[model samples]
Target: MDSMGKYIRGYVRIRLESPAPERFFSLCVHNRIPLRNLTQEGSCYEMELSARDFLRLGRFRRKTNARIHILRKNGLPFFLHRAQKRKAFFLGILLGLVLLAICSFRIWDIQIAGNRYYTTPVLLETLSEWEISCGMAKRNVDCQKLMQKIRQTFPGIVWVSARLEGTCLIIDIKENDEIPQETPVKEDTRSCWDLTAPWDGTVVSIITRAGMPLVKPGDLCKKGDILVSGAVAILDNDSQIQRYEYVRSDADIVIETRFPYYDEFSRTITVKSYPGEQKTYPFFTLFGTDISWYHTPKNTSEIYRTERQLTLTPSFYLPVTVGEIITIPYEKKSYCYTPEEALELSQKHLQNFLKNLVSENAVILSRYIQIKLTANRCRSQGYITIQIPGSDKSAVTPKEFPDLSAETTE
Candidate 1:
């Protein structure tokens, strides 16, 4: 048998003191008593055997006239004998298991995956709207229904998968990145809108697809000035105003403009330096209750870093979060950035600002920034000329645009 099998079946270590221990072994062989790890000292012999065989050794003691004593007893029976007195400890363990079992059937956490455009809070709000939330029974959550309901609620969500994983509801989503073609266009006269200039800039390019273009290339338009008119005037045979038709303004207009950029920061800052002193401690959180063995001093300044969670399953995380945290002690010191360093940092910030503009489909033409460094401050002020989308849709007022029916037409 293996070690666990021997331990589970119970074993005993025997010490035999006899003039001729060879006689006891010969007798054990004859009677079929297996001995493990047999070792001999000067006069006494030690060996291990099953607890049952130990009981049958009373006859062999008489036949060989050898002394037999149980030096140690090991196994499940012995452990149970010692643990019978600690009933409360065992009861607490059983209670904990029961609690975990009960909690497994109820969701305690929600995990969202494969979402980019839709935020976690937005998806969670949709789930909450459908009466799905943490602490609800897992059985009540139909995965198929959840997938269907989510797909129906968010038209942009092309695919969805919902599953219960170890007291957690995991939802994976795939959003439709392409423009929806099946979307119904709003033809409601009361909801007529116009594309107006969102910024004061000169138009660089204009393409009118579903509305009458009011501004062409090289034309200057101020903020709120209509760049595309939704109210297309219908002229009569004599070129007189008859009536007007309203539409949802749709067009693409790029405008060239200058954006003011200003950033100022102190050269002197407080920085933390680690002195290579860190202590790690294992921690466990059970249903919001945290237990840890390590504690930091009251006057200590340190950083606490938590590692990944420890769990029975590799990817599945339970309500009980187990992990290790390292406490790193550090010292805060005053540091000053040199002029060269400050200038480099300011340029980096400026680069990030221009990068964001590029991400929004804006083309940077030229940047004229003036950097000034004083006793303790670094400042950069300038304007960047760029071509960017300049049109914003707004509901057109009847008084503003001639989209409404003529009073005499009624």
Candidate 2:
């Protein structure tokens, strides 16, 4: 406690010179003046004491006839006193502290969580339109109103919450699971749907869950051909076919298909090389506005890139940022590649093109490639035969069953 008081109020080291130094020490002890690190040098005494106690020692020094001189002064009190002489420095520090305190009340960061189908940027944009973005005052944010607005904006969101955690505003959301609606069937009316082929391919496998299969494995089917029927024949007690009961058809079908791709590349490529001359522009960004602190370059053809560094608090809170824009001039040059280089580049391009077609359930069965080289260009054509799941109900159409009673009577 005493050390802390000394640090706050300040302390001074003093040298007391007197012919009767022992009497001076006795007077300090009798007067209850706190002294530390006391040392004697001939007839002089040196020690340190708090600034407040040093002021009160004047009366004791008069009685002991000791001349006291301060050797050093330390702590916050002295430092502040020195800073008081420089008005600009003092006001700048005061202004910075005031700005920091004010900025602490505003939202410096925004975070989103619990989102799957909805993207974070989409949610943030919605929140921004609702006046709940970074740099906005925290007191102005109405969590309940924001939640209601979010729910109204995205109907799929089942639950949402917006709250402030320190300088960051966190928005959490939950989305409703998507469930497919089943088609209804009535006893009086018979409604059936046909599962048609999506493309011209040979069927590799089929699994029917609620339908009668019309196409089997190894069967060649054309596009829009029915692969399954939802109509089922109903039997009576006399072993005769009665009315037809219709249902929604469900099935999983796999098909083998061939995909072809073609690409062409030139042997010569154009590349840009940087020159030596460069210019930099420094700027300070507050909120979303940039205040330039340096002159901007006038060269429009120069390539430029921006780098930003944020000024943050000790705890990693960002309220303002500093940025630099560096501009460099470059010259474009063309370089011709050898045949081997062109072949390698074309091979890499072909591999990348084929990689984009691969899926988690797709299996490659066969691949064929044909490369042709001209004087200045190379052309490559390739095709891959892959087996993939091809269950598509887009071509399905509902059909009404014909009345069997009328036909039997005829």
Residues 108-161, candidate 2, lDDT per residue (tens digit)? 888788898899888888777777778888899888888898899899999998
Each candidate's lDDT (Cα)? 0.85, 0.78
**Per-residue lDDT of candidate 1, residues 153-206 (tens digit):** 887899998888777788899998887588666676667789999888899999
Which segments of model 2 are wrong by more than 4 Å?
6-11, 27-34, 49-68, 74-81, 165-167, 178-191, 195-261, 265-269, 275-282, 292-318, 326-330, 335-337, 349-368, 382-410
Error of 2 at 217 (Å): 4.6
The per-residue C-alpha lDDT of model 1 at residue 272 equals 88
How far residue 46's Cα lies from its native spot in candidate 1, in Å, is 18
| Candidate with the greatest lDDT versus the true structure | 1
Question: Model 2: clashing residue pairs?
Answer: none
Residue 290's lDDT within candidate 2 is 77
RMSD of each: 8.0, 4.9
